[model samples]
Target: MKVKSFKYLLTSISVLILVYHLINMFIFWPEIPERIAIHFTKGEPDNWGLKYFLLVIPLIGLFLWWLIGLLTKHPEKLNYINLTEKNREKQYTMAKEIMILMQNLLFIISIFANESLLRYAAGMENGVFIFLSLFLLAVILISLFFNLIWAATLKE
Candidate 1:
């Protein structure tokens, strides 16, 4: 897909995720526990906070989308890991792809966390917790691995 289309897809998905959280927060506010799990350690919920703290997920997602848009709008502002006169264009393309992928991944992780916390608050089983955690780690690791390899292949 074209970069512009991919950017739009990311933005669209982010907005949809935010809307889902907001709607669910409002509809289920009364059902959520007084204190909800806000942090986890070793795959277990640890830190706790008021249920309303769930808003942080959508807020952070919004911030990530904005940051991604800013970066995509001005790729020149980003630092390159292997920038060179001959490889600059290819390197910048890779950087932009990384930014886009990161933006999407971060938003997805935030959404998963929000859903997991909401489930816990409602006294429901945390079914997605492990999957979400693993997915987030995998995306970051794979993105880094591929991007670095791609950068290495660029003409110097």
Candidate 2:
């Protein structure tokens, strides 16, 4: 996908997730406890806060969406592997792909985090954090593999 399209898609997804979260929060407002689990470590809640603090995920998502959109527009400003006149185009494409994937990953992670917070607030297990971590690891590995391929191709 084009960088602009990819950025817009990521932004749209983030906004949709935020809307879903807000609606879910309102739906479950009555059941939300006075104190909610806001932070976790080793799969255990370690910090507490007002239930309204649950909005933090969407807020972070919005900030990240904006940042990604801006960065994607200027891939030349990003650090690139094998950046040379001959490979600049290829490098920029690679960077755009990487940024797009990262943006999508961020959106996914935010959604999972928001859901985890809600589940924890409702006294349910927040096992998805581990799952999300694994997904992130996979994304990083895949990104590295693609970077290697692009770098090797650039040398040709």
C-alpha lDDT of residue 135 in model 1: 83
| lDDT for 144 (candidate 2) | 68
Q: TM-scores across all candidates?
A: 0.84, 0.80
**Which predicted model would earn the best TM-score?**
1
Clashing pairs in 2: none
Question: In order, what lDDT does every prediction score?
Answer: 0.78, 0.75
lDDT of 2 by residue, 1-156 (tens): 576787677667757766776787788778889898787787677998988777777778767866886787789888766678987887888777777777767766776787778877876676766487468758867896978776766772
| Per-prediction backbone clash count | 0, 0
In terms of lDDT, model 2 sits at 0.75
Q: Model 1: clashing residue pairs?
A: none
Off by over 4 Å in 2: 1-15, 125-130
Q: State each model's C-alpha RMSD to the native.
A: 2.3, 2.7
Tens digit per residue, CA lDDT, model 1, 1-156 = 578788788778867876776787787789977888888888677898987688877687768867886897788898777688888877777778778878887877777778778877887776776497578769888998988887766668
